[model samples]
Target: MKSFIFRQFEIRQSAEVFRVGTDGVLLGALADIRNARKVLEVGTGTGVISLMLAQRNPNAAFLGLEINQEAVQLTRLNFVNSPFHSRLKNIHQDFKSFSTQEKFDAIVTNPPYFEVSGSGKDKIARQTIELNFRELISKSSEFISEQGVFSVIIPAEAGNEFIKTAEEYHLFLIRKINIKGIENSKVKRLVLEFSLTGKALDESEFIIEKSPRQYSDQYLELTKAFHVFKG
Candidate 1:
C-alpha cells in the first residue's frame, strides 16, 4: 500500500498526482494556527497539510481545495479515516473559479513554483500552469478575514517575487522561515506568513538536516508531533 502512517493520521498516496513530502509537512507544522477557527488549504494534493494543521489546531475546521480529481478522492478517503473527519472537508475545484460566502481565518498552500518548458502532468505539479502567485495573492486578499493569516511555502527563487506581489495587494509579510537543506546549503525553500495588519516581520532559519541522513534538531523539534520517527 502507498500509505504513510503518522502519529495521529495516515495518508494514502496516488501515483497519478502529487504526493506528500517534507515541504508540506514543514509548512503545516510551522504555520501559525493562532486565532484560527476556520482554515482553507489550496492545492491540497493529498490534504496532508490540512490534516496536520487540523491535528495541531483542534478547534479549527478545515476545507481543502484541489484541482485534480484523483487527489480529491484520495484526500477524501484520508480525511474520512482520520480522527478529524468531522472537522475536515475536501473539494475538487480550481482555485481561480472557487466561490464561497465564507471567509477563512487561516489559508495555506504549498504551491507549484518551478519554471518549466512543457505541458505535461509533471508541469502541472512543478510549474504554475493553472494558478500563478499574483492571482493567489489577489484571491486570498479577497477571501481572508480582517485578522486572518495567509501562509505558503515556495522555492526561494520565486519566494521573494511572491512577497513583492503580495505587497501589491496590501498583504504584508508577518513571518518568514528560510529553509536550507543543510548548514552550508543555499536557501531553497521559504515558508512565509502574511496578514493585513502589516506588522513587523519575524524571520528565522530552519535547516532540514545536520548531515546526509540525520535530521537537524530544529527540523526534528518542529515536526516531532506528527512524525513518528522524531520520537
Candidate 2:
C-alpha cells in the first residue's frame, strides 16, 4: 500500500486518482481560514487539503469534491479514519457540474494544470479536457460567499493566467506566495488567495531547497507542523 504518514493524519495513496504532492499540501496549509465556518476543496484527490484545513480549524466543517469515483471513495476512507472525521465529507462530482445551494466561506484547490498533448498520447492528461483556467475562476466566483476566500496553487505561468481571468470575474488577489524548488531556480509555483474586494496584496517568496536534498528553513517551517518528511 502506498501511504504517507503526517503529523496528524495518514493518507492512503494507492487508490487515489491524483497523488498527494507539495502543491496540495502547500495550498492546504497556507490558505486563509481564520473565520471560516464552511470550507470546500475542489478536486480533493486524497482529501489531504481538507484534512489539513480541518486540523487547522477545528470549528470548521469541510466538504471535498472529486470527479473521479475512486478518488472520492479514497477521500471518504481517509476522512473517516481521521481525527476530524465527524466534520468532513466527500462528494463524487465534477466542480463544474456540482450544484450546491450552500456557498462555502473558504474554498481551496490545487487544480489540475497539465496541458493535454494534442497528439492524444496521454489518456490521463485528457481527463481534465473539460476544465480550464477560466472555468476555475468563473465557478469559484459563483460558488463562494461574499466575504469568502478562495485559495489555489498552480504553475507560475498558469497562475498568471488565472489571476488575469479572476480579475474579470472580480475575484481580487489578496495574497500571493511564489515558490521556487531551489534557492536560485526560477519561480515554479504560486499559492494565491482571493476575495471579492480589492485589498493590499500580501506578497511573499519561498524556496524549498538550499541545495540538493537540503530543505530551506522557510519551507521546513511552513510544512513542519503537518509533514514529517522535511528533507
Candidate 3:
C-alpha cells in the first residue's frame, strides 16, 4: 500500500486508484473553502483533496462522490483513517447522474482534463472519457448555492474554452491561479473558481519550483501546513 504522509494526516493509495499527485495537492491547498459550511468534491481519488480541505476548514463538512468503484473504496479507507474522518464521507456515485436538493457552499474537483485517446490503465482518471468539461460545469451549477463557488484545475490551454462553457451555465469566473512548473516558465495549469454572481476577477501566478528539483518559496509557504518535506 503506497501512502503519502502529511503533517496532520496520511493518505493510503493504490494502483487501481489515482494516486497522490501535484494537481490534487495544488487544488487542495488553493481552493477557497474557508467560508464554506458544506463542501462537495467531485471525482474524489484516494480522498486526498477533501482531506486537505477538511484540515484547512474545521467548520466544513465534506461529501465526496466518485464514479470509480475502486477509487470510492480507496477514498473511504483513507478518509476513515484520517483525523478528520467525522467530517468526511465518501460515496460511490457518478457525478453526472448525482442529484441533491441540498446546495453546497463549495464544490471542488481536480477533474480529468485530457481528451480520450489511448487505453491506458489510468484512462478514466486522466482522460475525459467519462466526464467532460460541459457536463461537469452544468452539474456543478445546479448544486452550488447562490454564494457558493465551483473550483477546478485544468490545463492552461483549455482555460478559454472552459470559461466560455461555464458562462453558458451562468457561472462567472471569480478567481484564477496561473500555475507554472518552474520560475520564468509558461503557465502550465490554471486553477479556476466560478460563482453564480460575477465579481472582479482575482488572478495570480504560482510557481512550483525555483530551480530543478527545488521547491519555490511560494509553493512551500502555501503548502507548509500540509506537506512534510524531507531534510
Candidate 4:
C-alpha cells in the first residue's frame, strides 16, 4: 500500500504517513484552477493536490508546504517524477512558522480531520499537519492574491465550520461541492472554494461509487487522469 498509482502520476508511499485518498482527489478535481498564476498547498501530503494542480494548470507555478519529514521526502520525489514537476517547488516547514514575501493566485488544501482521535504515531508529524480548520483559513487568507480562490477538501460536518471561521477574516464563500461515499450515502466531505468575494453560487454533490466494487462514471471522469486503476 506504500506505492499508489494515478492516471497522470504514480505516488511513492510507506515513507508517506498519509497516502492519497478520496478527499485529496475531490479537491483536485473540484478546484477552479483555470486562470490561476500562482498557488500554494498546506499540509501537502505526498504533494497530491500540488501534482493535481500542476496537471490542471500547466502555466501555474505552485508552492507546497509540508511538515512531515517522510512525506517531505516522498512529495519531493513525486514532484520530480510528475508531469508538471518543474511547475512545483516544495518546502519542508510548518505553515504557522513559515511565511513568505509572496502572494498566491490560488490556494488548495486537504487538512487533517479532527473527527477522530489520534494514534500517536508521530506526535509532531500528526499535530502539525493535522489540517486544523482555523489555521488553514487564516493562513490562506494571508497568502492569497485578491480575486484569487482558496480551495480545500475537508470533512462535511467540519466544512461548514470553516466557512464560519473564514467569515471572520473577510474571506467570502464562493462555491462548494459535497462528496459522498455512494449515491445514497451521507455527505462525507466538502470541496469548497473561497475568495474575497461572495455571491450566491452553484453547488453540487458527488457520489464516488455506484456500488462497492464499481466506481461511477462521474467519479472516474474527475479522477481518470490521476488513477491508474481506471482505464
Candidate 5:
C-alpha cells in the first residue's frame, strides 16, 4: 500500500498528488487550534493536517478545500478513512473563490510558496501560480472570526514578506515557530499564526533533528500521538 501509517490514522498517497512532507507535519503538530470550533484547511493535499488537528482538537469540525481534482479525491479518501471522519469534510474547490457565511475559528494551510516555473503533476500544489500570498491573506482575513487564527507553514525566506502582506489585511502575527532541520542549522521553514486582533507575539525556535537522521526530542514529543516511529 502507498500509505503512511500513523498512530491514530493512515494516509493513502499518490504520485499525482503532493506527498506527505515535514512542512505539513510541522503545521499539523504545531498549529494552534485548541479552542476552535470550526476549522478550515486550505490545500489539504492528503488531509493529513486536518486529521492531525482533528486528533488534537476533538471538538473542532474541519472543512478541507483542495483545488486539484485528483488531490481533492485523494484528500476525501484519506479523510473518510480516518478515525476523525465524523468531524471532517473535504471539497474540491479553489480557495480564492470559496465563500462561506460561517466564520472559521482556525484557518490553516501549508500553502504553495514557489513561483510559477516548473511543469509537473504537483505544480499547482507547490507553486503560487494558482493561489498567491496576497489572495490567501485577504481571504483568510475575511473568513476568520475576531478571536480566530490563520496558521500556515512556509519557507523561512518568505516569512517577512508574508507577514507584511498579512499586516495589510489587518492580520497581526500572534505566534511564530522558526523550524531548523537540525541543531545549529539555519532555519528552513516557519510556522506562523496570525489573528484579527493583535496580542503579544509568542516566538520560538523548533529544531527537527538533534543530529543527522535523528529526530529531535521536541519533534518526537510534539507528534507522539500521531507519528508511529519505530523504536
Candidate 6:
C-alpha cells in the first residue's frame, strides 16, 4: 500500500483499492480555485483531492461524492482526525444518481480510468465508475455555475477525448498541463481545467523528474505547500 501522510490527514491506498497517485497531486495543486467560493468533487476516492483543495482554499466549502462505502468511511475517519475535519462533507452517494439541486462554483475529479476490458492491477481505480467520457462532460456541465471551472486528471488519450467531449457540451478548455516522468518519457497524464469559452486556452507541460532520481524543481515547488519535502 502507498500512503500519503499529512499533518491533519492520511490516505492509505492499496493496489486492490483505488490508490492515490501523482496525477491527483498534479490536478489538485494546479487546479484554479482562486475565485471559487464553493466546490464539488466527484468520485472522491480516498478524499485526497478534496483535502488538498480544503488546504489550499480555506474559505471554500467543499462537497465530495463517493460511492465506495469503505472509502467514504475511511475518508470520514481521516477527516475527523484532521484539524480541518469540520470543513469537509463526504457524501456516500453515486455521482450518477446524485443531484446536488444547486450549481457549484467548481467541480473536480480524478475519476476511474479503466475500460470495461483491460488488464491492470488497479482496474477499479483506473476506470470510469458509470459515467463515460461523454457522460461525465455532459452531466458535469449541468452542475457547473456560469463561468465556473471544472478540473480533472485523466489518461493522455482521454485528455483529447475530454476536450472533444467538452466541446460538444459547450465547456471550453481554460488551461492544461501535460505530465511526464522524464525528459524522454512519453506523456502519460494531463491536468486540465475548463470554463465556458473556447478562446485562449493556456497550454503547458511539466516533467516530474529532471534526472534518474531527483525531482524537478517545478514539481517540488507546486506541491511544496502540502508535501513535507522541501529542497
Clashes of each: 0, 0, 0, 6, 0, 5
Off by over 4 Å in 4: 115-118, 122-131
Candidate maximizing TM-score: 3
Per-model lDDT: 0.90, 0.85, 0.95, 0.80, 0.94, 0.80
Residues 25-96 of candidate 6 have per-residue lDDT tens digits of 787788888788889998777778888888888888888887777777777766666667878889888777
Order the candidates by lDDT, highest first: 3, 5, 1, 2, 4, 6
Better candidate by TM-score, 3 or 6: 3
Writing each residue's lDDT as its tens digit, candidate 3 over 1-231 gives 758999998988888888899999999999999799999999999999999999999999999999999999888988998899999999999999998899999999999988956768788999998999999999999999999999999999999999999999999999999999999999999999999999999999999999999999999999999999887
Compared with the true structure, model 3 gives a TM-score of: 0.98
In the predicted model 2, the residue pairs found to clash are: none
Give the Cα error of residue 125 in candidate 6, in Å: 2.4
RMSD of each: 1.4, 2.2, 0.8, 2.1, 1.0, 2.1
* Candidate 2, residue 86: lDDT: 98
Candidate number achieving the greatest lDDT relative to the actual structure: 3
**Candidate 1 TM-score over all chains jointly:** 0.96
Candidate 1 C-alpha error for residue 188, in Å:
1.0
What's the C-alpha lDDT at position 177 in model 2? Answer: 93
* Model 5 agreement with the true structure over 59-95: per-residue lDDT tens digits: 9999999988988998888888988999999998999
What is the overall TM-score of model 5 with all chains considered together? 0.98
lDDT of 4: 0.80
Which model is ahead, 2 or 3, in terms of TM-score? 3
lDDT for each residue of candidate 2 in 86-122, tens digit (9 for 90 to 100): 9999988778887878988998988767776555432
Per-residue lDDT over 66-163 for candidate 1, one digit per residue giving the tens place of the 0 to 100 score: 88888889899999999999999999889999999899999999988866765566566678888889988899998898899999999888877899
lDDT of 4 by residue, 116-141 (tens): 45576544434534446787788888
Residue-level error in angstroms, candidate 4, position 159? 2.3
